[model samples]
Target: MSDPVDRPGASGVPEAVATPRSRWRIQIIWLVPLIAVLIGGWLAAKAIVERGPTVTISFETGEGLEAGKTKIKFKNVDIGVVKSVALSSDHRRVIATAELTREASPLLVDDTRFWMVRPRISGGTVSGIGTLLTGSFIGMDVGNSTKPRHDYTGLEIPPVFASGVPGREFILKGADMGSLDVGSPIYYRRLQVGQITSYQLDPDGKGVTMHVFVNSPYDKYVRADSRFWQASGVDVSLDATGVKVNTESLVAILIGGLAFETPDDAADDAEAAAKTQFVLFHDRAEAMRRHDRIVDTYALVFKESVRGLAVGAPVDFLGIVVGEVVAINTRYDPVAKQFSIPVEIHLFPERFTSRYTKGDQGAGGRLTADRQKLAQTLVDHGLRAQLRTGNLLTGQLYVAVDFFPNAPKGKLDWSANPPELPTAPGGLQSLQESVTSLLAKLNQIPFGGIGKGAQKTLTDADSLLRQLRTDVVPQARDTLAAAQTALNSANGALQPDSALSQSTSDAMTELARTASAFRSLADYLERHPEALIRGKQEDKK
Candidate 1:
């Protein structure tokens, strides 16, 4: 090929050597495009190696989510960003696709939790205030599982407590949720130690099951016999004892809360395990009350009014309260044709036995037989139930079971459903009966007849007095006047200057003169004879 080219080039100057065109050459313009392509390929391969795992989170609403704008955070540090937000095929939820960094890849586990960070106020707590100034972001709570997950359901409500917080969870079974919500404080001796986490209606629908978390130190205090009660507000009670007010704390008063305490008697009980189940009492009184294992129900039939007596009234034995009235009913006896009041009372025999004896009370059957025999013996010995006024101001009545030695003899009706116990008249009712009997006796007296007889006698006495004043008084006055005139004449005749008194004195003097003359004549005649003249001998002397 070189010789032919040389021969063909003969037309040209043979001396001029025509060299073949150069096969290859470098151009400056092409180098620029080649370098650009090589750099672009390298960058794409690096991006594929460094990219993190993608996750999709379903939310009920997409309120604060944005594509290419919203960020995913863990512990306030950005770990990922939302790539897109789209509705699910069913349109029931919003699906957000987020791209996390390579470092966060291992954190995407089965139990990882996510929630939106926004301003919230609940259960006496304020959170996420900083989110108001900054924007809302996706919050992540790392899980403790090795298995990874690419799909998750976001929580609508934020957790009351964060993961890794030193605490324990417990279950409380309650009749109802009494003013309680998530984040309500749980107190121990009025100190906040925990908070309620969640609650749900029981499957049986009989009660609610609540979940609560207690911090580390306080969690140790929870024991097997620990008592729990609702301490939502001030528990104010006005009863026979007096007015009582109970509360946990001011926070409990504002929101709602629960309180727990280990009873002093049960201080040695074993510590409760995590997720322990407990019964939530309505109040502390019920929670603290000692449970009675043996209960005896009896019916007391009273023949009097139970006006002031009410259900729940204490049934007192001697000075001790042994039971309470469970029910009160009016019953009519068709056979006897009489009405009576039957009060059903639940008596705790253990209360009576524990005061005198200790140890196991007895087996159920034997215990029941012993109680029946004891009750019969007591009834035979004049043990009776009576109603008495407990509070005069409140007109509250209570059952008083006592020994009434003089009470009429009666027997218990053991065949009755709740074995009937003998009842005596109420104290006030006895007093009323005595007063009524006295009034009835007084009413039986014939006061009208007595009054009529008295009136007749008084009329007769008045007539007799009038007759004396009209007839006897005038006759007696006339006789008295005649007698007074005669007395005056006799007095005048007996006076010293009267003529009869002077003539009597003169006659006495003339009789004395005559006797002297006679004595002188006799003396002269007998002067010679002798003694007859003794009167004359004095003259001789």
Candidate 2:
């Protein structure tokens, strides 16, 4: 319609004058708003990407835990934020839903566990308070465990930290639980390398199971052929020595520690499955197989008391601890019609195998395998059972193996079967027999004749005393009267105030001193008869 230039701005004056400036203004107005919208969309995408995925971790209690506040930590660094906390379908557990950053997603392995961090009593565990201020989440540990990873249920009490390792699980029965304490050290060759993990009573409530864990590398050192004993609590005693025990540390002596030893014959299988965790001093099955010798046990049955016996007492084969008494039980034997106690004895054949063959086949071609030859060698080398006293106060007896070359061998079968030799006599039996024997011997003596002779001697002495009284007393009295008459005549001749009175007083004092000396000599002789005998003997010598 109108002119082309007049169409612009619809002003008749000039269309070109306002056109450039107006378009510039319009472009400037729309550019800022579009740029702002694009920036907002980019920020939303970045936030979603940083948030990563939501994972659910279940827990028993959420006491110190807060949803949307607590963070999941890995290696002491914050990695994720907890989204929400809600009850599971059972309503018994709390499930913490967490959103982790994409950077942390790769760290979440199958073995990852989630446990709440709070201030604990024994040692303060402080965490998540930083998250409360910074609005960040806690961290978690994620890695493959050597042992199968178990889902964590919140601990009612504080849980102890333990690293999982591959090892056989053995239950040690009949262990003294009070003697074993948690954190007590376990020794291999007197070197402490492990600690007791935990302990609990068995289901049957008859025994205690001690959980011991050996750290890696050292775990391989412990084989299935290991032997264990309470190294710290064992006691040894001697009559003269009194009680002797090795007590190095107060903690070891009081708390009691475990010891493990490897045998010489143990297989050198390096690839064998290591026993990283084992129950100490229990599990006899593995221990028995590891020991290559048969234990010899003897039941010492006696009608009378045997002297010197005690538990932890040794049964010696030539003064070695071949075995010990495991138990003492009493039963009435119908055939014997007497109550007999069976003392269980255990013997380890490894100690004596060097001298004797194990099997019955006399070693056929091998001289080293003959049992009879071994028995003969022992007898020829002067092997004998010597009765040794164990506890003098308890009167317990132990039969000690001794070498007696000159001792007479009685007529008994040493070959047919090892003869049931005598156990050293102890207890009331020895006292009863000794008393009975003494009484029997006393009955055999001629006591009646001896008593009559003593009575005759007394009668003769009495008759002599009567004779002395009748014959000697009158004559002595006459002599004394004559002496007194003579003393009076002499005194009268000497006169009252003469030098003779002073002389007489001095003479009487001298006589009294002599009598005192004689009394002292008699007392000394009576008190020390041995001194007199020794003086005479020495003089003769």
Q: Who wins the TM-score comparison? A: 1
lDDT of 1 by residue, 1-541 (tens): 4665557556665465788876687778999999999999999988899999999999999988999988999999999999999999999999999999999999999999999988988889988898887788999998778899989999998888878889799999999998998999999999999999989999999999999999998999999999999999998989999999888988899889999999888845998999999999989888987756678899998998899899989999989898999999999999999999999999887666665444554644455559877788788999999999999999989999999999888787778889998899998889999999999999999999999999999999999999989998999899899999999887877778877677877888999999999898777776556655453355554
Worst 10 residues of 1 by lDDT: 532-541
After superposing candidate 1, which stretches have Cα over 4 Å from the reference?
Answer: 1-61, 83-112, 142-153, 174-180, 200-209, 230-249, 281-286, 293-312, 326-345, 357-386, 404-425, 428-541
Best by lDDT: 1
At residue 137, candidate 2 shows an lDDT of: 38
TM-scores for all predictions: 0.64, 0.52
Estimate, for each residue in 122-205, the C-alpha lDDT of model 2 and write its tens digit.
Answer: 212233455444554344655565443323444333223433454332334445664666666666666765666667887888
List candidate 2 segments past 4 Å from native.
1-60, 77-112, 119-200, 206-272, 276-293, 304-308, 332-340, 355-388, 391-424, 427-432, 444-541
